[model samples]
Target: MILPVISDIHGNLSALERVLEKIDSDRILCCGDIVGYYTQPNECIGKLRQLKAISVTGNHDLACVTGDVHGFNPYAKEAMDWTKKVIKDRNIEFLRNLKRKIQIKINDVNIMMVHGSPRDPISEYIFPSTSDSTLKSFLESENADILIMGHTHTPFIRKFGDKLVFNPGSIGQPRDGDSRASFACLDVPANEVKIYRIKYDIDKVVTAIGDEKLPSFLGERLYDGI
Candidate 1:
């Protein structure tokens, strides 16, 4: 089975639409952060709902839906507050009801999905630079053949023993100095993972941010991918 996984879509509907259009897969799994940062929170939520994705609760999603922006950075906090006010009731409810982690068995491989590390799940930041011991502990705790996560907005794939940990990167906001949308396709039958980067109209998203009067920094970061 070919599963296309996406994550960290911070309310950039245009980018999400483009990514969805380009990916062809049987199932869509989102790692969370469905709403935050960018404009069009309602539209993004609508599109995600239409796709019927199995989603986990991202920190931004939780903050926006629950009106608890304290955990976010200043810029993120400000943007999330604006998004919370602008998001529709249905969308907010959707986010409020999302799970923090999802475990699925596909083709005899145990796949665990979370917004961050399995240990802390929604709040941890697990990156490439993260300690190997920490990653090992997380895998041991989850005991999954494959672990997928997103949070730092950087794409990565790490293998510890026979298990694999992968991050498909951020769809809306990529901090890896690349404005392109990042995603991953897991070929369960082949036991292979492929990372993909697709270019979209960043200028269009930037324009939409301005039109929506979202955080000014959001528009500026698209070009720099910060």
Candidate 2:
């Protein structure tokens, strides 16, 4: 099976659409934060539902449901408040019901998916800067051949012995200093992961943010992927 892995799509439907259009896969795995940064939360949620993506709940998604934006930065809190106000009732339920972690086997490869680290599935970050000892600990703890995660909005693929841990980055708000949308394709039969970056209509997203009266920095950061 070929699966497209995506995450951190904080409601920029244009970016999500572009990423989906380029990938051909049997199923899509999302690492969450489906809604919380931009203006099209409902639309993004609708698209994911249409695709039947296997997803985990992100910290932002949880905040939207609980109406608690504690620990979020000022900009994220503002967006979360707006998301709670604008998101449809059913979509809110979808986010509310998402799992914090999921384990699945595809073609005999045991895979684990989470929005953040397995230790703190909804909130912890596993960045490229993370020490090998820590990453190895996560892999050892899960006993998964491949551990897939998001939340850092930075794409990376790391290998420890035969085991792997990867982040597909942020489809909507990439912060790896790349302005393009990020995703990954897992080829189950071959046990290989390929990362891809696709350019979308940043101007359109920015214009929509402006139209929605969202924070200007939310739109501005997309151009630089910061």
Candidate 3:
């Protein structure tokens, strides 16, 4: 089975649409943060709901539901604040019910998907430069063949012993300095993972951000993916 994995998202429906259009898998695995940092929160949520993407709760999703974005930086907090005001109750309900972690078993392969790390799903970040033990922490309890996570908005695939650690980066607001929507594809039986950086209409998202009156930084950063 080939599974398409998407993460971050951050409420940019244009990026999401572009990424989805490029994906050819039957089922999509979403690593959370479906809303926040941009406009079209409802539209992103609606698309995810329509696709029935398997997802985990992201920090932004929790913040939107709890209305507590105290730890987020100024720009992120501003977007969260704006998101909470305009998002519909149904979308809020969706965020409220998101899972913290999701585990899937295909044939003999076991896959664990989380927004951050398996230890702390919603807040922890798994970076490319993380220590070995830190990476091992995610696979300590569950013996998953593949561990998929996202939060840092940087894409990388690392092999820690037998576990394949994957982060598909961000769909909406990428911080990798590439300015392209990031996603990944996982082939189950073959035990292979492929990453993709997609190009989209940055102007659409930027215009929406301006029209929505979100923080200027959010709109400006979309062009550079930072």
lDDT string, candidate 3, 1-226, tens digits: 8899999998889989988888876699999999889888999999999998899999999999999887899999888889999999999999999989889998988899999888888898888898877777667676888999999999998876557888999999889899999999988877778899989999988888788787778888888888
Q: State candidate 3's TM-score.
A: 0.96
Better of 2 and 3 by TM-score: 2
| TM-score per model over all chains | 0.95, 0.98, 0.96
Clashes of each: 0, 0, 0
lDDT score, candidate 3, position 124: 87
Q: Residues 63-134, candidate 2, lDDT per residue (tens digit)?
A: 999998879999999989888889999998899889999999876888999998999998898898999899
Best by lDDT: 2
> Which ranges of candidate 3 are over 4 A from the true structure?
none
- Runs with alpha carbons beyond 4 Å of true place in candidate 2: none
User: Any idea how many clashes model 1 has?
Assistant: 0
Question: Which candidate model has the greater lDDT, 1 or 2?
Answer: 2
All candidates' lDDT scores? 0.85, 0.91, 0.89
